[model samples]
Target: MKKIFCFLLILSLSAFGFYPSVSSASEKSQQEVKEAKQYVQKHVPILKNEFKKLSRSSSLEDIESLIEKHFKEYPAPQSLKSNKISVFDAFPEKQHKYEKFSGKSLNLNNLLNDIKTSSTGDVFTFESKDNTVKVLLGEFGDINILEQKSISNPSVSKAKTTKATGIQRQTGIGYGTYGTKLYTLWCEGNFSYNGKTVKVISKDGDYHKHPSGSILTLDPRGLGKERDASIGKYKYKEVFSRLRVEGVLGFKWGEWIYKARTVETYIGSTVDGNIYGGLKSYK
Candidate 1:
């Protein structure tokens, strides 16, 4: 049953593709959605009653809550979201080999080979704001990320030729520790060194600051462990300037770790490809 659920989940997610223009197919669209719901109830009886119950209700809140319950109530025993990243916010000893680099978004096979770790059960953690989830080096896996290109934006990149000892920090009224401002760049723009672009983000490369040019000193090192403050002890959303994740994917909505064979990195061409900030990813 669990295997069937996973297969169905992947199928449904991958099936979310282009639809006909609504102007001429509004009724057909509505009918298809209804039929899709019926198909689920017909095959998955546990959802049968809930689907009927949801159909009679008109409140968005109720609909959302019901949808959540639909998955929660599934028979499979799954892990729920952690209250804290860890009880004391400490990370486990690193088990997988890690690497960090700035390069074009390539295929999963290429990325995996680039990592050069042949251990079974190995995973890749692209620290960019998006691609840090750990995925097993399975001969066969279910996550869609592995097949997708440019999923992570370089959330935090350092200077290439830094003469200083640490990243530049500023005290501003923003996120993380109250009144703790930092002069860090989010994963929104490109970073360059010398004449060639050195940094790349997964998306939003056109709307933010782009330096006419400057020299940078980019480093290639495996990320270190950073811990989250426990519970109320945390005043803001916890973040890691750098990290190497080692974890498993989950089936629930709250599970941030998704499984797929392909993932993406920022490409300089993608940044240059944007016309008036209308950048897009076709995968």
Candidate 2:
């Protein structure tokens, strides 16, 4: 009687489509795993070579072009169409920790090294620290990459000022937001009271977009008082001895999202010789 009841239960579940045939499902899963493993074994050498090429690049433009070529040749699989893949300008070191899809931290370089000796049926899964973004190596070696989306809107912060040799120096802090992610920008300008001229002495900044690297550029030219200037999509406004520099942050493909595509930053000098900065974004 017990055996009969078990058989009937199985039949009922199968009829309702609640219990797929265990053997068939298992076989399919095994096949997918096999394919995934084969894909990784076949592509690992090519990926290594690509990284080697990237490491040799000397300029940002060259790196960007190489990455574009790499993507064109090895596009993400269909399973990861909605996920962003983390591409780097150079290979990451073993010490960096990235988040896994399971909410655990993983060392990506270590995993890549392990792939050199990975045997059949071995699976690897990992994620970047950007808001739990994931990368998987199963079921056709799917790699799901998601951007860091934790930045707030742009804002400015005031910083200190100093004076030497009739020249005033000011440093400003600017915050840039992409989606919900935040990154920082810093700018320092030198002003000469005698000539009423402003010169951007030094500038540095970065953003929170994972894998997609951040770049900051500044124009070092001196401007007369009350003069306006433009560089690329950025603009500088000078009013009396006060100066305001504003412009949109530029990004390459695969580095930004569609909703908040344009990130902007502005750094200005107050009449009292203080520095103020802020950032903004738009589609």
Off by over 4 Å in 2: 1-33, 53-57, 82-283
**How much lDDT does candidate 2 score?**
0.25
- The lDDT for every candidate, in the order shown, is 0.21, 0.25
lDDT of 2 by residue, 88-167 (tens): 10112211221112222212222323545432112222222211111212112222121111122212224323321212
lDDT of 1 by residue, 180-233 (tens): 111112212232222222222112311111121011111211111122222453
Model 1 misplaced stretches (Cα beyond 4 Å): 1-70, 78-106, 109-186, 190-243, 248-267, 270-283
Indicate the residue-level lDDT of 107 in model 2: 23
